[model samples]
Target: MEYLIPFNRPFLTGKENEFVNEVFRTRNLSGNGPFTKKSQAFFENRFGFGKCLLTTSCTDALEMAAILIDIKPGDEVIVPSYTFVSSANPFILRGAKIVFIDSKNNHPSLDENQIESLITKKTKAIVVVHYAGTACNMELVMSIAAKYKLYVIEDAAQAIANNYSFSDKSKKFLGSFGHLATFSFHETKNISSGEGGLLVINDKTLVERAEIIWEKGTNRNAFFKGIVDKYNWVDVGSSFLPSELIAALLYSQLQSLDEIQKKRIAIWNQYKNGLKEWALLNDVEISYIPEYSGNNAHIFYLIFNTSEKRDNLILKLKNKGILSVFHYLSLHKSPYYKDKHDGRELVNSDRYSDCLLRLPLFVDLTEKEVTHIINIIVN
Candidate 1:
């Protein structure tokens, strides 16, 4: 059942092995070693993030953020219903109640206008996912959070190496605007360490505590920084850091990010241009890019008029040895959360749950192969 074209293939920058070998030579495979520092510095210097720490996965980073923010039972956190489970799961684990936000009609990001109405006295935070690397309206989101005095965490797992335009014609990285942000370097993401995550602390006040939470609730980082003579457990935390080996591989990936993004954007453009006419004729919806968001090319998805058409198309592509797949189901309607939902329908989230289809998108996917995929889909 091996499809000639898989849904995703992790790209290698060729320097990964060399970097990992260097880590082995340093004889420090532990977390927060030389390789980890190099990787973290790369992000901080490149994105101007306040402070960055690598974690085992994005979920762990979010969990650390949850702890830093002091989430408590009965506290409410607003999250988009069309995102991966990790976006809400971390808050839920801290006993915070999740208030699901609906997606925008023509885009997968949460409707920023609806965020204000969902806040309450008990609301503690708003978690925004920059779906497909396109930003949610950061200006409005931050303003609302200020008005309500709520925390904002950007689940920028797919948003690395991308920019968000401001209303003043200024721009910044997607992960920079939120008080705390998390990113993934999963094999399928634009960047890869196979299994790694990052937490960016934009709020200066949270920086010191975030480091404590990252080191399993200890002042271990302070000790290393020579700020403390002795380090001991001081708070609740977990083993959130990834091994130095993962960071080594990631540093290599970071070195080639521009090259990788260039190729990915080209692939996304091919899909858009190739399918434009076919989409209009078939009454289907192709990828949508908001003017304020950079096209990071994290995904190029299609939406059929009905789930049947999307499913049938996936099956058809499979028959041709091409792998195509559906994206997230609405979290509010999921079996685990169905009863927990407030009975309010999130129409756009539900629509994407059924109609959205993701095609093969990887660095190795060539122009000829893309054309072939387009030809099959159209005919």
Candidate 2:
């Protein structure tokens, strides 16, 4: 048998070792160092975000966003049922009621058309996850948010370097549109820092509070910058920042973002092309990338005709020494949220939970490996 191909893996290139060695030489491995500052600056300058903070993980970033928004008990936050649990867990931890919405047909993102009906008097925010680096209908989501006067938090975990273009010639990065957005540099993401993430703040009002929360409720960030005489407890918060070492690793990935993105896109396209005929024959659906969106090709998934077929495909792949996987069991149906679920059936979300299968697509995967994986699926 061939070497088992895993679903996704991180690739280290360029300055990974160089930066890590620099951090070691400097002996400043704690939060907020030269690498952290450089990483924050890179994101702010390249993505046009108001501010960026490197966090321990995307989960921490979401929690920071929840803290900034003051998600009190009974506050309702609308989110897609098809996303990772971290997207909604932060709000839940803060005592907010999660209003889970279904995905749109043919896509893993929340249905913008359905968002309005789910909003009630308690709706404080809308959490939109850019599933697989593809953009959601932000225009519709933004309009609904404006009408309701709610905060929009983007879970752009898979969307680093991805952009959404508008007809008016304006282009916005995935993390740029939301009041606050979170990104992951987990080992599985396009960029990796072993286990790291970032929080991008787009709203000026939230920046100061966000920093305080990021620094464990203290005004330490201000003190460090000489903006304050001493740092002390100012509000409720947690330790959200990662060590300088992680930032150093991520800075290396950021330097080669363009090259990584190009290679990933090529792999994604190869899968799409290889499976096109099989998909058509089986009446299955392939992931769609809208023209207005620039995807990072962070993931490549296919939807089978039925849940049974999806399961069989997984078994087949595993037997063949290929480790394909499924993503996101609908949060509404999970044990934690089932009792709290709103009395609505998430049709599209359920469909996605049952039918989607992610193939092996990684930065280090070779053309031959991709062809082999696709051949297994097609056959």
Candidate 3:
């Protein structure tokens, strides 16, 4: 069924075609070409990340993080239940036990306060997802990881340009806080390369090994750089790198990040202002951005009072030629993991699973379209 307003439309900067043409002219189509280098350099220079590697998708990036951390059988990695399966799949594939945590009461971010109690002798890492491009409490998360000597892998798939401000008046990008982090450039994300992702290495120790893993577990990258006489397989990995075409497309999007963010934030503010009274009256909750975190306006979701009401709203929007949708079901309660899950109930994660509704939000969505959505919701 087609709708006048779709749930999402991928936005393209006018320069994408030109950049791809440049890649063609250069005759380097595979990964780690000039375009890939430029793309990696952009993130590393802008965010001061130790190293960055473009991957086929965020899942691949997370997989690289898992490999870098050496997750083995019986190792437990704590993660929020209310997130995309990619967050947990990587570690699970390494035979690590995923200790699912609950979301915060007011936001979809993992509850940082409950993290310590979940840590056991088997715990090796804490993976945190910055939902809707907002920052999780990195200070608390990092302190806990430090105390326990655990690795922190941030699933910053939705948080590309988002930043976190500290009490010292310093600011850090969301992906920069973790020892390893991942970012997505899927069509649904703030930035798009059709399908692409980035792996950020903040812990300098992982940089060399990450490069090797990114190059199909070989020392090929070092060989190309004249550091190694001959490249050979030294570690376990897969083909995770994106082709140069994807990097070219992504670099084009990165060039327009500021303009895209400006439009999105404006749309977000309009929704907030328009629906404030209605949300209050209806007892619905809007997406919450903490003071320390900078909003990139990646997503604008509403938490309805009940699942029935939420479902009704989706149907109503559909009837009106609009498209709104819901996000992740609790992974702990997922069919594949339900029986495997321990008997502990994650209250907030379940609540979000039942009630959170994501409205149409994209760089191309106009104010008129946004107002139309708000009118349907408020009325």
Candidate 4:
């Protein structure tokens, strides 16, 4: 029997060990250390983001975004039903009502065209997740938000370093367009720090408050910069920062972003080429990359003709030693949210939940392994 090929695995290159060793030598493993500052600076400079705050996980960043926005009970936040629960969980935790929207027919992002119809007087914000590292139509979403005076929070968990281009040839990095954005550095992502994430604040007005909330409602960030003589609790908040050890690991990953991305893109292209014939013959559809968007090849998922075929394919792939998987179950259909659903049917989201399957994609997957996996699927 062959060795088991895991679904997703982290890849480390460059200075991970050296940086981590440096952290240990310094004896300062807590947050807001030298590495943390360096990592934050790296994000701001490379991604053209206004500000960046490293956190324990993408969930923590989203929670921070929720608190920064002051989400209140009865306030509604529009989000896609096709994303991980963490995307919507923060708003729910804040007692804000969730308005689940469907995805576009060809992609796993919130259908921007359907957004306007869902907006109401109670809608305070719109959360757009860049599913599988493919960006949503930010221009349209931003336009709608501006017209309705709503805030836009980007759940960019899977979109670190992903770039998007517009029809007019203009381009923007995924995390730069939103009022606030969140990124993940979990082991499952392209980058890994065991468990970590970052929050990017594009709205200058929210920067100071975000830092306060990040430091457990204290103006310690200010105090540290000599702007304040002392720090004390000034608002309701929590500790969202990660230790310098995690920052050290992430910095290593960030330093090699280009090389890691190149390898992943190669694997993504191999899968597409290898599966094209099988997909066509089976009447299935593969993922599409819009001309206006440059994806990071973060994930490669295919859509089968029916839910039954998708399930059978998973079993077949597993039997053949290829471990493929499905994605999020629509949030609106979950027991926790069923009663809360606003009676709107998210048809596209349901379709995605039923039919999509993610193939093995990661930085370290060898060409021969990829070929073997593709052969199993194609056969």
Candidate 5:
């Protein structure tokens, strides 16, 4: 089952071991240690995010957002169907009804135009997933949220280092627009801490409570800072913080973010150029970066004309000792949610479910390996 080229190989910044050794020397192994603080501060300073907290996983961060937003039973939350389950699961756990939206005609991002019609009196929030690191139209999204007085959460799990440019060419980081945002550092992401995530609080009013929730629903952080005489449980929360070891590993990659992004975008361009002609002849659509979004090269995929063709390409790559794979299926059609879904059909989401194929892409993947993958596809 092994392949010469796999879908992903986590890249290390060479300083990871050095950082881990420093953690050991300091002997502060729990969460919120020096390493954790440094990693959190890096995001806040670099991206201008209001406040940051590292979590055990992106799911935990989303859960924290749900709590902060106070999602209640029967409240409806609009979300795109073309995404991983984590995008919607957090709100569902809070007893909210998920009103699934369709992907845009030419892009996998949720259609911003269709959002308003779907909002109802029960609607409480909108969850936007920046699929393959492309930002959804934040200007329109924020305007709609403002009009409806709804919460907006950016699920930036695949979008670290991505920037969204407005029409005027002013740029803002992907996770900075939403009232709340979350990120992932899974091995497959641009950054890796083995498994880690972050919650960004753009609403300063929520900063104090977010810190409390991140610290197991206690006022312990305030107590340590001498703001409170004694810490006690004051809110509903969980043990969301990841240990210092995860932060140490994550901070090492933060220092190398610029280099990692430059290399990835270069590789992405190579695939686009090499496959341009063959893809046209074969009617295979290579991925496109939206005008408003800068490429972070989080994924490079092809959309075949049919499901059979997509499946065949996977087998062909496998036969040649390479590995390629598909991404999220329509969550509205998922087994657990299928019957629960209203009868509306999401055409683009379903098409992507069947035809989109993600090729092998990672920092460690060499040029020779990439050319081999392209040649196989074009052949």
Candidate 6:
């Protein structure tokens, strides 16, 4: 059924076509062209990140990370089972065993406290997802990684512009905390191209090697730099780069990021304020951002008292020409992995799986449309 209000509608900043036209004028349609380099450099300089490699999708970035860390059979990687499949798949594909952790009782972020207990001699890395663009407790994660000599991969797919705060009253962007991190520019994300992703390398040691892996296991990037007379296949990798056109489109969105963020945050506030009273009276909980996290307003979701209540609300909203939706099913219990799972009960992961609902959120959603959604859900 077509609804008056849908769950999501991708927003455009009006400069996308002009940039694409420039790419055409230059006649470079392949990856790592002028637009691609400019976009990569923009992210590096703006975020203070080390070498950045643009990819076709966040999944590709994560896959590159798995290869970089040399994940292999019998190796274990710790990750939250509450996240999307991409968070775990890359490592799993590399023959690494996934050690799924539960979410914290308060938020969907990984229960960092449970991480150490999951680590073993076979543990190679910890993949942490900053769910809903909220920051995870990086201090604890980093300290633990240091203690065990493990790699930390921040699956910052939803955390493009969010910051992680420290007790010293200083802040670091979410993707910068881990040795390696990934970000998404999918249409549903805060800033987007049609489909794009970035791999951020912070270890410095990994920078040179990452380029080789990014260039389809070749030294082409080095050869182009005149660092080598000719390039050859040097390691394992793939064609992860997006076309110059995609980069051009993404660069246009990045230009207006601050303005887009302003509108999104305003819409997010409208939802929170509009529903706060009703949520309390009805015994429901809206999305919560901890003080240590910066809000990017990436998504607005609610946790109902029970799965039944959540399902009922969705049906009621649907009847009123509105579309509300649920999020990921707990991966540990998924049919594909249940037999392989160690069978530890991930209570909070299951709780979120059954009871959480995501509401309409996008840059183009008007106050009137938001009000209509709020009023329908309130009643």
Poorest stretch of ten by lDDT in candidate 6:
42-51
Q: Candidate 3 on 1-379: residue-level lDDT in tens?
A: 9989999999989999899999899889999998899999999998888799999999999999999999999999999999999999999999999999999999999999999999999999999999999999999999999999999999999998889999988998889989999999999999999999999999998999999999889999999999999999998888999999999999999999899999999999998999989999989998899989999999999998799999999999999999999999999999999998997999999999899999999888889999989998888
lDDT of each: 0.94, 0.92, 0.94, 0.92, 0.94, 0.93
Between candidates 5 and 6, which one is better according to lDDT? 5
The whole-model C-alpha lDDT of candidate 2 against the native structure comes to 0.92
Q: How close is candidate 2 to the true structure, as a TM-score?
A: 0.98
* Candidate 4 segments exceeding 4 Å error: 1-3
Model 1 global lDDT (CA atoms, 0 to 1): 0.94
- List residue ranges in candidate 2 displaced over 4 A: 1-3
How do the residues 151-241 of candidate 4 rate in per-residue lDDT, one tens digit apiece?
A: 9999999998888888889789999999999999999898889999999999999999999999999999999999999999999889899
Worst 10 residues of 3 by lDDT: 43-52
| TM-score of candidate 5 against the unseen true structure | 0.99
lDDT of 6 by residue, 162-253 (tens): 89889988998989889999999998899899799999999899989899999999999999999999999999989999999999999999
**Model 3 regions more than 4 Å off:** none
**Which 10-residue window in model 2 sums to the lowest lDDT?**
1-10
Candidate 2: residue 166 Cα off by (Å): 0.7
Candidate 5 wrong stretches, greater than 4 Å: none
Pairwise TM-score winner, candidates 4 and 6: 6
Using lDDT as the yardstick, the better of models 4 and 6 is 6
